[model samples]
Target: MNPDNREWERVDEKMILVMRLTGAGKSYFIQQLTGMNVSAGHELKVHILYLANFVAGTEKCQVIQTSIGNTDFAIMDTPGFDGTTRSDAEILKVITEQLSIIRLGYNLKGIVYLHRITDNRMGGSAMRSLDIFEKLVGEDALSNVVLATTMWGNVVDIAAANRRDSELREEYWGSMRRRGSTATRFDGTRESARAIVEQLLGKKAVVLKVQEELVDREMSLNQTAAGVLLELEVYAEAEQIRKRLEQLESELKYEKDSNKRLEVKRSQRRNAKAFSQCAEDKKTMKSKPGVEVKGKLKKWAESGGKIGLQALQGLAAIVSISFGIAGFILGAGF
Candidate 1:
């Protein structure tokens, strides 16, 4: 039997995507919801490396079919945005591949984005994941998104947790909540998990931005809205690292102590390695070919050369790799 046929064996099942950073309790939530013995690791490295190991007798990005109160669901336990073993670009590629499969005939009822309440602050990785998620879903489908915070049981200070929760709604997740996306808590119980799933039970199936861009618009991964956002972030980080290297170079020259000078050299080496990785990530982003911009030079000429020097350089790179110029414009939105 073909794998695609096996996937759609039950056409009536409602599809849901459960996504978050690693160790945010996605697998545990699924285990609670479906009564499946999916492994939800407590250790950070274990969770990052193996959270998606066992689910519905399948591996990563596979659907776990289950039922709750007569409504059958095919829940997707997605890989985390920050995986120790996979780059963000690779993780996005895996997710898009699964989305492509889901688009074949399934209805993606909703998305559950999980966050750890124990986290003291919204770090760069978390913010990047959220940004990519927003671009992937687009503003039009915000109503179908549920921002869920988990790991309440592990929190020591209830007051602090409550304050953080408020901060999430008012500060971090403010825009998403105001735009029809809701905020909720998952208390690590079957009932709580069921309630979260039930919230999306009646929502109409949504066509995510990535789905439209990748499938309907025939855009490449690099040219998609989310992809462009990731690229811009990489470029920005690389630029920051470049500046840091220059600062470290100056510090190393002026340092009198041997120990301090060694530390500066170490910092320089680290920044250089990070900058090189960013460049490699950029290359990976533009590797896959998709819809090409017909008359690419003509479009660039018509833009009156006003897209800025940075955007023009980006356009040059895209044209060299046969990607569309739309990616640069998409970056402007961020």
Candidate 2:
């Protein structure tokens, strides 16, 4: 691919900006998305720059640039770690700087707000700051606002954690909507993070698999394309019908198995009740001798309990045979 004419430069067609709070996996996110490896191990000493265009007697607009991929991408790393620099003041300064850039003919593309997945809870401070930033940046800027939740690898239950991340996105997006700020979720796993990058690039991005974690399966082009087409109610009706049929088959198999289990349980329960009744009859026979035994046997015979009581009755026949043999041998030997 020729570097100059590459579609990759489309990122530069607009003034793209990434605004993230401190330690929100911004560095890792940038590395994964751009395939750029910085600060790998040795201290090569890289410097990030924030260049300001001066107006009158004061510095007005500033552009923060970081080197990622073959491109020099502009980004704003907010909530600086300087002890004296408060988060509110840094955000205020960045807003002022961006406004100055807008006046000086720089068009803004979008903003990505980096959020840490390590903290399951969103800080009120961050929420309040986002509100202020959105109000200053205007509601159109919300289209540019992306809430990136990072560090998914540390989660124990990946599926549950992902669900939590999704819930958080819904809440965050709803909050943004309430403030007239549009936002989307950028949960930084290999799959989702790449998807978000592709959306931002406005094209299906070619992804090089670096490491696989948490992604259950890799979806194919045909599947994804088909899915997207289906969303538009396009010409994929046949494929949808096939998928529904497969789902119905699976459901039918499940119901069949469930019914079989219910029948087995019912049979077992009936046999158990019959066995208990037989034991009670035996106890009555011991207490009341011949009369109770005859009455009880007659009742059981009349009640259609024959098949159910067959197992217990077979044991009784064995006992009677053993007793008859004992009696005959004793009489002959004596």
Candidate 3:
């Protein structure tokens, strides 16, 4: 048999990942593609406190092997750690470790990002997850990413779905598409699911950026692209929040009315939450690997250098908010 045409069994399977937020049709999409019921897998990685300390093993990633047409695939389903059960830190750790193990054995093909077609709009948490995903995979490997949206059967408005798809292509998914990522839709049927796999069937399998960073470069969690970008965002947001807090404190000093001071105090408390989270973010990055960490984050996180954070955040807001607003304007009802 030709090496290229060989249908490797479980041990030598061509693997791809199917990633999405917790309920964004990841399970249904996989079943449609693989002809297997894989719902029983993907338990959360449990951490136990023993003797007043905590420990955990890598347990979040699940792989199932199935053949469709002439090719054999090991589909890796991820519980996209969107801070529901596990923190992003834990999620990143688990995914990197699992992929490292798989990299030694299988030909990791590409990433299948399953998004829901009926999302009303891309919610904030979903957007953040996608942002982290891009940082994990990097711009160089985007050609290996398939932005495959599912749950089309639930979407009643055909034109609306198309608009949403276009909106994603133009706005949310635009940069990835420009970098060679392909976007497609998956209806619920088995035929449709197989078709999704067919699209990536011929693409050459490649090592993901996460695998390269963690395995090849032997970089620590903070030194990795995803980790650095995450810390940068937290630091930037913290700096912004700190400015707001200072202004509020200054105003409180000048304000005379008791009611107004109380209002300022409430606002300060709310802003303090962001401060506490930022402090925790810094602490986690420093302490997780059991080393004293030091280094400034890169000036610009994207492929290019030094795009202002304000400009990036503004553009993201415009793109994200427009998805919901465009539905109404285009007569694509929610």
Best by TM-score: 1
Number of clashing pairs per prediction, in order? 0, 0, 0
Model 2 stretches astray by more than 4 angstroms: 1-13, 39-73, 80-84, 175-195, 201-334
CA lDDT of every candidate: 0.69, 0.38, 0.62
**Can you write out model 2's per-residue Cα lDDT over 13-125, one digit (the tens) per residue?**
22444555556676566555544343322111223321122222221122233332333333333332222322233223333323222222223445566666666666765
Clashes of 2: 0
lDDT score, candidate 2, position 231: 24
Clashing pairs in 3: none
Lowest summed lDDT across 10 adjacent residues in model 2 is found at 321-330
RMSD per model, one decimal: 13.7, 37.3, 14.5
**Model 3: per-residue Cα lDDT at residue 103:** 48
Q: Runs in model 1 with CA error above 4 Å?
A: 1-12, 41-59, 236-280, 287-334
